[model samples]
Target: MGSQSEVMHCYEQIAPLTERMLVLARAKQWGELPRLEGQCSSMVERLKDIEPLSTLDEAQSARKYVLLGRISANSSEIVGMIMPQLSKLVGVMKSLDRQRSLHKAYGQPDDAYLP
Candidate 1:
């Protein structure tokens, strides 16, 4: 509530996280899965103003879309404050994806990553 500048800066930070989350969903590393899970309560809170999110996979791109919708709708209420947590979550998820993608790309059929 301090200023619009403050809010927009927060939005900037969250924007990249949304992209990173998209990749995480694609990678499906799923190591720090708690970060995605914990947001359910926050999403529940936003439901009063934001549209109800679909029953999409919680740790996937659809979930990220729901978050972007909420963030766009309630930019003022949420942006500045959620950064640290979301950044940390996305950071770890990215790290996990880097390794997970490699393990997957080079994986043998018996490695359990194959269909």
Candidate 2:
């Protein structure tokens, strides 16, 4: 929980994180996405605890809109790039699981021949 000013400052922080997320996705750093996502979730939760901001001037309001738009665009692009890879990874994992199950049912040792 923080003051209104601090919450507004968080909005500023979110834009850069969104940019970093975009960069990470572009670089295929799938392992890092969850960490950044956790950070984003924390910030959003902080923002949620506070009341809506009503003191922003026109210029600040416009800037907020632009930053939010950028964040949205970055998120969309990241999802687009990651979804296919995620699908493929899931398929591979499912195949491995099926193979393991079949091996268990056959009760064959690791090096045993199976017909």
lDDT of each: 0.50, 0.81
Q: Lowest-lDDT window of 10 residues in candidate 1?
A: 48-57
In candidate 1 the C-alpha lDDT for residue 86 amounts to: 78
lDDT of 2 by residue, 1-115 (tens): 3465666677888888989999999999889989998898888887777637536667767887887898899889988999999999999999877777888788966445435
- Residue runs of model 2 more than 4 Å from their true location after superposition: 51-55, 109-115
Give the number of the best model, judged by TM-score. 2
What lDDT score goes with residue 22 in model 2?
Answer: 91
Best prediction by lDDT: 2
Off by over 4 Å in 1: 36-115
Tens-digit lDDT track of model 1 for 1-115: 3333333334344554444444454455445434743453444444433333233244544555665775565443344435655798999999867767887778733345434
Clashing pairs for model 2 are none
